[model samples]
Target: MRVVVVGGGIAGVSAAWAFAAEPDGRPRGGVSVTLVEAEATLAHHTTGRSAAQLIENYGAQALRPLTTTSLPFFHEPPEGLTDAPLLTERALLTVGTVEQDEAIERTLAEGRLANPTITEIDGDEARRRAPLLAPTDGHRYVLEPESADIDVAGLHQAFVRGFRAAGGTIATVTRLDAARANGSGWRVETTTGPIDADIVVNAAGAWGDVVATAAGVEPVGLTPLRRTAFMVRSPWDHESAGWPLVADAEHTWYLKPDGAQFLCSPADETPSAPMDAKPEELDVAIAIERINSHTTLDIRTVASSWAGLRTFSPDRSMVLGPDPDHPGFVWCVGQGGTGIQTAPGAARCCASMALGEPLDERIDPGGLTVDRFR
Candidate 1:
């Protein structure tokens, strides 16, 4: 069967990889996969603009299972697809103020559901983990030791390499204009050219609903939310590279070490129309102000910054599996901020539903499927 997967972000590439390979990483039989991206390169959007961390205790409860399912792939990827490890040691540390006592409790409770190893740490312990943090009287802390830094580019590249090795086609700078039912399959129109496929996977990041509408299907009501992240000079000791990612329990701001610089984000969730997102000046200013208020680093200037869309379904869970009304139209979108961490399992589920196969026993797949919304 010929399957065309839209969007070239991590999700698209991973979905293509899933369709091209068996669960055991062997090339599948009787399946032809084509991946199309509008940009000249893959992962030019949210996939590339993530915080690059794999924290199981994130996103909605429905998505935590995907994180669990994807752990093996991220921890031990297919051989020869990567030259370096896909993940590294980097703990997630969430701090809280007295005013946010409820938030801290909620985060602790939610975090434990995803990882039983999650535990609370005192302010002094948190300070040891991130010495740059300004000591506060009422500050509380929680640590997810299993959380680690994800090599986002490496993971995406691995998917691309594995898919290509399986004879899958990749079309860059190709935009899908429309799709229509042709016989028992689909005729997809694109800027690069037209193609016919037996199945279509809508992995389009922020433009998921757009892709669905173009295919003559009802929209899934995906809302693109803007999240801005920026890099600033390191203000701590050189060895501070081992510092855990420091974040507010309220999620107002977060900063993590990356080389000699630290990546900071306001964790803003402003609604926006689907498009190539750009960082807002106001958002950057807000992040700097918050980071300065909480940390010893007086971040006055930024080295670089970018914004990406974190699209979500109406209910805030991912929309996977085949459309109930149109089995040929499968959804692998609505990842929100969990896309990078959840890519592997999300892609696997997408391919399984598209090909009428069963997902692994570990993933329930019931909560994540498109039928949840129906």
Candidate 2:
């Protein structure tokens, strides 16, 4: 079967790779996959603009398996695919004030359900892990030492390489203007030209609903939330790169070590649509204030700033599997900030549904099924 995967983010690329993989000598043949990206380059949107984190316990319960399933790929990756390791040691620290103790405990409890490696760390220990954190920022903290920093670019490139090596085609600068159900497949018109496929995978981050509408499928309530991130030169002269990622208990702001600098985010999720995103000055200033107040690292000036959309479903969980009303029109959007970490498993799931194969044993397709959203 021929599959046309929409959106060239990590999910789209991974799906194409999975679909193009050689089948296990079964009667069914491997699929021919074509990946479409609106931009001139793939991953030029949210995938390229991520903070590059891999927190296993992050996101909703249904999505955690995607992260867990993706860990192996991040650690060892497919051979001959990437020159550099995709993941490096990094911790995640969630701090809270005394008044916010209940919230912290609740979060830790939820995290333990998916991440057994997480543990409660006292204030002093938290400070030791992230010396930049101020002593007064919070009274308690939870630490997930197993969390790692993912090489977003490397992962994205690996998928692209794997897909192409498996004979998958990628069409960049191809914006889908319309799509229609034709016989047993779809006829899609893009900037480049027309294409027909047995399945149309909707991995279009912020433009997911737009694609659905064009395909004559009922649009799901996929809301794109804008998340702003900026880089600032680390205040310390020493190698201040190994510090763990720190975030407020309320999920208000976060800062993490990025090379010799730090990447800070206000953790804001403003509703938006697919477009060339830009950082808001007010948002950046707000993040600066939050980080400066909570850390000893005097972050006065931003080295660079950018924003990306984190699309979400109404329930905030990913919408995977086939659309309930249109099985051929697969739904793979609503990843929000978990896209990079969940790409591997998400792609596998998408491929499973696309090829009519059993879902990967590593992933629990129950909660991630598109029927839930309906």
Candidate 3:
């Protein structure tokens, strides 16, 4: 079978790799895979502009298993896929003020259910973990010690390497124009030309619905939400390196240490179109204000900033597997903000469902499949 995966982001590459190779990284017979990217490069959008951290307690309950299933791959990736490890030790710290005590407790309960390592700590301990946090009274904090910083580029490259090694083809600068059913397969029209495929996987990120519409499939109500992030110089220098990723319990703002700088975001989720996202000055200013009010960093200037779209299904869960009506049209979009951390298991599940194979025991997608939306 010839499988054509649209989009070259982490989701697309991982899905293509899974379709072409076995879990142990050996090439799979009787199947061919091709990955097509709209831009000249892969991961030019959301995948490239991510605040790359893996927090197991994040995302919806139905989607958390995907993160859990991906842990093994991050810890010990396929031998020849990458030279360095894809994950580095880091932790997540979520804080709330006295007024948000209920919110903190709710979050803590939910977090503990997903990851037992998640624990609540006092304000003083929170400040010790993230020294920049202000010494506010009645502050509540939850810590996820198993969280880590992901090597976003390295992980993407690993999938690319595995796909290539399995004899998969990748076509950069090739955008899918449309697709139509042809007998038992599909005639995929692209910017460069046309190709025939037995299956067409829609992993177009923010353009998921657009791709589906172009293929004459019913839209799945995917909303692309914009998230702004910027970098500021870290005042503590090396001391900030050990600090955990700190965020407001309500997710109004977040800060992560990166080398000599700190990556900060407003955690804004404004509706957006499927296009190249740009950071808004107002959003950055809001982030600075919130970060300053909550921490001692008092951010004054932004070294750099960018935005990315985190598309989501109406239910806020991923839309994976083959569409109910269009069995050959696979859906690998609507990752929301968990795409990077869940790529491995999500890709494997997508491929398994697409090829009529059983899912891995560890991955429990629950109600987050394509049929759920249908």
Candidate 4:
């Protein structure tokens, strides 16, 4: 079977690799895979811009299972796929003021349900974990000790390497223009040329709806929301690398230590079009203000800034599996902010469903199949 995967982000590469090989890393003999990217290189958009972190209690409830299922892969990747571990120890600390006590309680309950390691902490404990936090009364916190930093580039390359090793082809600077049903297969027209495919997986990220429309398939209302992140020099001379990622309980802003600098974001989700996103100066300034007010880190100047689009379905759960009206048109989009952490399991499920196979027993999508959108 000939399978064509559109997009070259983490989602696309992971899906292509999964389609070309088994979980044990053995190449599937009967299947041929092709990955098409419009950009000059892979992961040139959202995947490249991610503040790569794996938080077990993060993202939509339906996606939490996928994140859990992907943990084994991060802990022990397939042999020869990567020389180093994909995950490094890091923790997430969510905090709020007395006004947000309800939000903090709700988050703690949901987080502990997903991972028992998630626990509530007192104001003093939260301050100790993140010294930069301003000492204030009625502060609440929740810590997810199992969270870690993801080696995004390494993970993406692992999938690329595995796919190439399995005889899968990748076409860079090749954009999918349109696709039409041709008998039992499809004639995929691209910017470079045309190719035949038995199945087409839409992992186009923010452009998911556009890809579907081009293929004459019903678009699944994917909304792309822009999130801005910026880096600032850490003022503290003492060791700060051990500090956990501190975030607002309401997700108003967040700060993570990175070497001599700190990565910060306002956690703003502005609606955006499918394009290369850029950080607005206003957004960066607002983030700095929020971070400064919450912590001792008086961030004044930004070293750098960037933005990425987090695409979501109407329900915010991922849109996976084949479309109800188009069996050959599979979906792997609507990752939102969970794409990196959930890539392994999500791709596995996408490949399985696209090939007409049953989902892996370990993976439960929480009924996030594309059929729900219909």
Candidate 5:
């Protein structure tokens, strides 16, 4: 069977790796995989622009299972697949003001449900974990020690190496024009050439619905929200590598230590059409103001900034299986904010439905499958 996976982002690469490998890292029988990317290089879009975090309690409730399942892969990747560790120990600190008491409760409840080890902490401890929060008023914090900082590039490359080593073909500068049924299989037209495949995986990020529509399949409602992030010089007088990822309990903004600097975001979720997203000046300015008001850092200049689209379904959960209406058309999109953290389990699920493998024991194929949209 020939499997064509669209998009070369983290989700697409993860799915391709599964199709290209046996559980033991050998080439799977009879299944040939091809990963096609529209850009000149892989992960030039949302995948490359991610904040690169591995917070287990993040995203929709149904999606938390995937995060837990992906931990092992991030912790101990396949032998010789990655030269360095994909994850590093870093805490997730969520703080709230007295006015946001309900938001704090909701965060704690959701976080504890996913990771029972999460603990509520007083303002002093919050400030201790991140000294920048020292003077912030009306703030309290909850700590999820299990969360960590992920090496985004390293993790993405591991899958790429695995896929290539398994004899999978990667086609860049190949934009999918459309795809349609050819008997029991599909004939996909691209900018470079045509590909005939037994199945096609739609991992097209924000272009998910567009790809579906081109293939004569009904479009799933995937709303892409733009999230802007920027870096500012760490205003701390001393080293801050020991700090945790600090996010507002109201979900308004977040900042984390990065080398000698700090990465911050307004957590903006503006509705957007499918395209290459760019950071708006206003979004950057707003994030700076929020970060300044919440912390001791009086950020004045942005070192760099960028934006990426976080696509979501109507329910804000991922769609990761064969489309109910068209079995040949599989849905592996709608990652929202959980793309990097949940890629492994989501990919395994997509590969099974595409390659006729059994469902992975780690994943709960409950509300995440594409059948929910029907």
Candidate 6:
């Protein structure tokens, strides 16, 4: 079988890699995979623009399993595939106010499901973890110690490398403009050339529906929400790093420590389309204001800022597997904010479905199926 995987982000790369590799002890040549990307390079969009943190129990209840199943891959990537580590020590601290105490309790309970390491830290403890946080506003805290910063680029490239080593083809700078149902398969037109495939995996991020329409498949009502992130100089001139990722318990804003700098986002989720995203001035200003109010890092200037789409289904859970009405047209989009954390398991699930095999039992198929949307 020949499979054409669309979108070269983390998802596409993982699917491609899995298809070419001997997944679940499946025999090789079960499927020939070809990954296509519109951008000149893979991961130039949401996958590349992620905050790159693994926070268990961070997304919807149904989606938590994907994040859970992905931990092993992040903690221990395949051997001989990477020259550098995929994860590093980092913590995610969710702070709450007096009025939000109930919500905080609920969040803490949820965090316990996938992260037993989660613990209630005192305000002083929270402050110690993130010294810049304002002491007065700190009312409650829950620390997800298992959460860590991910090497997104390395992970993405690892997939590409594995796919190529497995004899999978990668066509960059190629855009699928149209598709026709050719019997049981599809004939997709791309900028580079036409490709024939027995299956087309629509991992097209924000352009998922467009690919669906191209293939004469029903669109899943996928909506892309715009999220903006920026980098700023650390409050201290010296390396003021080692700060745990700090955020409002309600996710109003967040700041993660970077080398000699900080990555901050307002956690905004404005709706947008499939296009090159840009940072809005007001959004950046609002993020700065929120960060300043929550912490002692009174950053007045921004070093750089950019935006990316966090696409989601109507139910807010990922829509994986083949479309009910169109089995050959697979749905791999609608990852939302948890894409990076869940990519490993999500990609494996996608690969299993594409190859007509049972899902890896290790990967819990809770909120990852298309049946929910049906």
Instruction: State the C-alpha lDDT per candidate.
Output: 0.90, 0.85, 0.92, 0.91, 0.89, 0.85
Summing lDDT over every window of 10 consecutive residues in candidate 4, give the lowest-scoring window. Answer: 359-368
lDDT over C-alpha atoms for residue 184 of model 6: 92
Candidate 4 residue spans exceeding 4 A from truth: 362-366
Clash count per candidate: 0, 0, 0, 0, 0, 0
Tell me which residue pairs clash in candidate 4: none
Q: Per-residue lDDT for 229 in model 4?
A: 96
TM-score of 1: 0.98
Clashing pairs in 1: none
Model 1 lDDT-worst window of ten: 358-367
Candidates 5 and 6 compared by lDDT, better number: 5
The predictions' CA RMSDs to the true structure, in order, are 1.1, 2.1, 0.9, 1.1, 1.3, 1.8
Clash pairs, candidate 3, are none
Residues 1-374, candidate 4: write the lDDT tens digits. Answer: 99999999999999999999998788999999999999999999999998889988888887778888888888888877889889988899998888998989888899888888899988888888889998898888899998999999999999999899999999999999999989888999999999999999999999999999999999989999999999889887437877899999999999898887899999999999999999999999999899989999987789999999999999898998888788889999999999999999999988887777887675665567877767
Order the candidates by TM-score, highest first: 3, 4, 1, 5, 6, 2
lDDT of model 3 at residue 7? 95
Q: What tens digits encode model 6's per-residue C-alpha lDDT throughout 73-166? A: 7777776567888999888899888988887998888888777889899988888878888878549888888788899888888777778877
* Residue 184 displacement in candidate 3 (angstroms): 0.5
TM match of model 4 to true structure: 0.98
TM-score, model 6 to reference: 0.96
Off by over 4 Å in 1: none
TM-score versus the correct structure, for each prediction: 0.98, 0.95, 0.98, 0.98, 0.97, 0.96
- In model 6, pairs of residues that clash are none
Which has the higher lDDT value, candidate number 3 or candidate number 6? 3
Best by lDDT: 3
* Regions of candidate 5 where Cα sits further than 4 Å from its true position: 136-138
Tell me the TM-score of model 3: 0.98
